[model samples]
Every structure is written in C-alpha cells, then in structure tokens.
Target: MPDSTRQRRPFRREGPDLRRRELIDATLRVIASRGMDAATVRTISEEAGVTPGLIRHYFETKEDLLGAAYDQHMTTLIEMSQQAVEDASQPAVRRLARFVETTLSTPVTDPEALQLWAGFIQRVRRDEAMRRIHRTNYHSFLSCLEELISGALAARGRRPSPDDLKRLTIASNAVVDGLWLEGSALPEMLGPDELTSIALDAIGAILGLDGLNDDLRKELDK
Candidate 1:
C-alpha cells in the first residue's frame, strides 16, 4: 500500500561527468579493497550510493566501466608524475629528479594503488578494450619520461639522437618501474628515501647524469 502524502523525496540531480567520475572512483575502491571479481555493477552502485540502473545508464556494460576506471587510475598516476616534472623554476635535471622522487613516494607508490593496478593488469592481456587503455596510458607515461630525459640531457649539453632518446627513455622507465613495484609491494623494507636514492642513482648512471646523485642529496637536505 502506498501512502497518500508521505512527503515523497525528489531525486537529486548530478552532472553526467560527476556521476561518471563517482562511478569510476567507486569501481577503483571496490577493486582495491576487494578483488576485481567483487566489482560488479550492483556492488559499485552500492559504493557510489546510486541505483544499479544509473550504472547501466552511464556505461553499456560492466567491462566498459572497468575500462573507464582503469583509464582514470592510469590518467591520475601520469598526471601526478607530470605535475612533479612541471616546476618551471627548477632546471631540467632537477625537474627530472623530482619526477623520479615523486613516482617513488606516497599516493603514487602506495599499497592500495598497487592492488588496484594488479587487479586491472590481469585483464589487460585478455580484454581488448582494457589492453588498448593500458597501451595508451603506458605510452603517455613513457612520453612524459622521454620529455624529461630530453630536457635533462640538453641541460647537460649532450643531445641524444632520436634512437638514443628512445633507448634512454625505455631504460629510465625500467628503473623507475622496478623500484616503484618493489617499494609499493614492500613498503616496510623500502622506504621512500631509499627508493628514490636507488632510482636516481640507477637512472642517473644510465643517462650519464652522475650529477643527479648530488642533486638528490641537496633536495633531501632542504
């Protein structure tokens, strides 16, 4: 039986972008806390405080929403890393050093973040859409690293050719990725300071920018 005048509540309207972001954030949280298997539309809707219909309204399928969530996660990580390298006042070498430092530090190198990444990475191979998103984000991050490396090399008056720049970027990225994984997975064993120091040393050596060690020491002392 329906009440004649029970003061029915009106639904609050949210912008499409806001709604989508909320859903994506909810998906990431669910995946990070539980596993990807637990990130169903019903679960995500509950997390976002929305109706399951709303999720279907925003996304055609569960896979689409998962892809969007992965996209948001990777975009955020890349933006944070890019922002770290965007200090115009600092020289290129220092900015590059900052990028390394930022990537190996909190929020970016977090355990929950690692969990979210591990969850999505499993789908990256078998899922075509997820694979595309992963490839796009990987290149985006790599491009950022390449730009920083180019600028740092130019600051040292050493202009690497296109091939050399690509190689340098790949090698530097490998160092950062390796350390980021280890630090995120073993936070107790690898503190931020140690992670950044090892990353800068290894990357600096590869780039022939030995001065990076001194730069890092100065930054830490500050």
Candidate 2:
C-alpha cells in the first residue's frame, strides 16, 4: 500500500480528536492486515501502542471502534475523490476524468482497501449500525458521481432529464465499482493505465458522450 492511502497521525498526541483518529487509523491497519476477527482490544491497543484502558476511554466497545474505523475508511475515499475534482481551474471534463483516474488508480484501488472493505461488508448484513453506515456512504458516493456526470453532460451542451440523470448515474457508478473491484482484486490482470482507459471508454459510451474517451485520455496523460 502507498503512504498516501494511510491516514496521517499528528505529532502532538494530546488532543482528543487526534488521539481518536489515531485509534481509528490503528483499527483500520489491523483490520486490513489481519482479519477483523483478530482485531481485539488487546491487539488494537498493541497496534496503537496504547493500553486497553485508553482504548476504552475513547471507544466504549469493540463495535464502537469498528464503526469509527469504517467511517474513517469511507471518509478517506470520498475526500480523495472530492480533492481530485476540486480544481476550479480545470474544465468539467477534466475534473470528471481526474475523478475516474484517481478512483481507479493506486492507493484507492489497492489490495489493502479491498480487504478493509470486504471485512466490513461481511458484517453489514448482520449489524444494523454497519448497514446504516454502508447505506450512507454508498449513497454519498453515488450522489457525488451523479453531480460529476451532470457537469460533464452540461459541458457538452447536453442537459439530461432527471430520469436520464438517475439512469446514467447508476450506470456510471456500476462502471467504476465493477472496474475497481476487478482491478483491486487482480491488479496484475491489467497493465498500468489499462483500467482507467477501459473505465473512461465504458463510461463515455454509457453516457453517449462522443469523444469523451479521447478527451479523458488526453486529460489524464497531461
């Protein structure tokens, strides 16, 4: 995993928020490297270099800590996408292309991320809190993608109806999710830049955006 994927820790470790975030990061690292089942209080405390009592001070139960970790994971992914598209100087098309490229590229598409996601996914069905978190994050991601799709279409002088936008958003999300899963699961199957190229092509076709594939390729290459 790249360093960019890992959450940064504060040098001064006295503040509550900083300490809590550190604990969350430690929990995520444990869940990613070892299975979630192995992330007991003792293990997480050892990983965080804190006493189990300190862990209790921050999180009342293991479930609370796990939930926080899951929230952090989802937040990090969303923040990366937002940052990629936040350059006001860039055109809408470039922003959309950057969003796809960043989502499909390293760190975000890493094996560690896949493992962490899978670990939480297995529990979402049985845990009500986990299910809620999953729903919130999933919809938030879809909403962001929909906004980007709308911008991309408008950039080309095409304004989609609400129904059209809904359908297109679902399809575009499927393209990103499908490619992300495959690429993360078996990165060696595709060479560098292949997954992003495929994603841009498929998304462009789905949205009926002619020349979008080429446009995105040029945007990413630059």
Candidate 3:
C-alpha cells in the first residue's frame, strides 16, 4: 500500500534582498498608476503578491518603505547612466556622447520615471531619510559626469583645474537635468534625436569640445 501522506515539497522562500526589491517595485507601480497616496502597505502587498504583514516585517513604517523605493529608483537611474558610460573601447568623446544619448532616451526619460520622481521629490524636502538618499544619488551622478567630462577634456588636450572641473560638472548636470525633465514631462515637444543633439552640443560647448555632436552623428551614420 502507498504511504497515506507523502511529504510535501519544501516551500522555496524568496531571498531577503529580492523580496525587498519586489516590494519596492510594487510600491513604484502603485505610485505610478495611482499616485503616491495609493501606495499603502495593503495595496503594495497586493501588488507584490504578499501579505501586509510581510511588508511590515521588512519595513518598520510606511515612510521607510517609501524612502527605500525612492532610493531604489534614483540608484537605478545612476546605475543605468553609469552603464551607458562603461564602454572603454570607445573614445572619451564618444563615451560622453553615449552617456548623453542614453540619458535623453527612453526608460531614462520616460513619463513614468518622471512621475515616479515627482511623486518622491516633495517628500525629499521634508523627510530626512529621503533627503539623504537624494543627496547621495545626486552626487553619484555628478561624479560620473565629472569623470566623463575629465576624460573627454583630456582627450582634447584641455585639462581643467579642479575648481573649473567642478563648475563644469555642475553646469553640465544642470543642462542634462533640465532637458531630461522637459523631455519626460512633454515627450511630444522634443524627440529623442533632438534632445540628444541639444545635450551633446550644449555639454560640448561647456567642456570646450566642439565636435561631440559631430562625432556622435558620424558614428551613428557609420
């Protein structure tokens, strides 16, 4: 006779990091589709296919989860931007050009990304944790830009002083941020090609590298 009760297969539990990320992703989706006010524990749990208690187990408070989500969102943006600048085989100018092109393109400049950012920006002003995350991510992005700018300028035989490089990085970041905001908020107003061209031209002029746009255009043509 067969055993009356076969042992059930052991359940596979999700790793802590993955579970946390899933929760954060769920939170973003809820906020994206229905605004930040709808991203309650219960709602996020439903989206993540877990119980509200599971959320509480991972995050002590709703604000903590929100902060985590914001951190994840900003960190992902910085990472993608870094990845865009990672091709060492390309010349520094082309690398900088790629960085600008990727930043101004889809996913990075999507309406949903803008929505997610807008949803978190207000909280960043009031919440200390959120503000810290913002500052850290902002600096990470600036460092990447500064590195690319340094390489590009050096390639052109123009090595800027540290102070000058600092100013240039800030200015370049401002241009990219402004254009990114406009492109994301009003996608119809400027296409990706136009945005990339304007960013490359503006940053190139700032860094004294006049051929960035031309270089990128030539690469694309080839």
Which candidate tops lDDT?
A: 1
Arrange candidates by TM-score, descending: 1, 3, 2
The number of clashing residue pairs in each candidate reads 0, 0, 0
> Residue by residue across 64-132, what tens digits does model 3's lDDT show?
999999999989887887898677889998999988899999889999999999999989888999999
**lDDT by residue (tens digit), candidate 2, 15-127:** 89989998999899989999899888887877787777989999999999999899889879877877888876787777777888889888888889999999998989999
Model 1 poorest 10 in a row by lDDT: 1-10
* lDDT per model vs. reference: 0.90, 0.85, 0.89
- The parts of candidate 3 lying over 4 Å away from their true place are 1-12
Q: Name model 2 segments beyond 4 Å from true.
A: 1-13
Instruction: Report clash pairs, candidate 2.
Output: none
| Candidate ranking (lDDT, best to worst) | 1, 3, 2
Error of 2 at 139 (Å): 1.9
- Residue 140's C-alpha lDDT in candidate 3? 91
Q: What is the alpha-carbon lDDT for the whole of candidate 3? A: 0.89
Candidate 1, which segments miss by more than 4 Å at Cα? 1-10
lDDT of 3 at 157: 92
**Please, what are the lDDT tens digits per residue for candidate 1 over residues 1-222?**
222344423468989999899889989999999899999887787777777898999999999999999999999988998887677788889889998999999989999989999999999999999999999999999998998899999998999999999999999999999999999999999999899989989999999998786896787699
* lDDT minimum window of 10 residues, candidate 2: 1-10
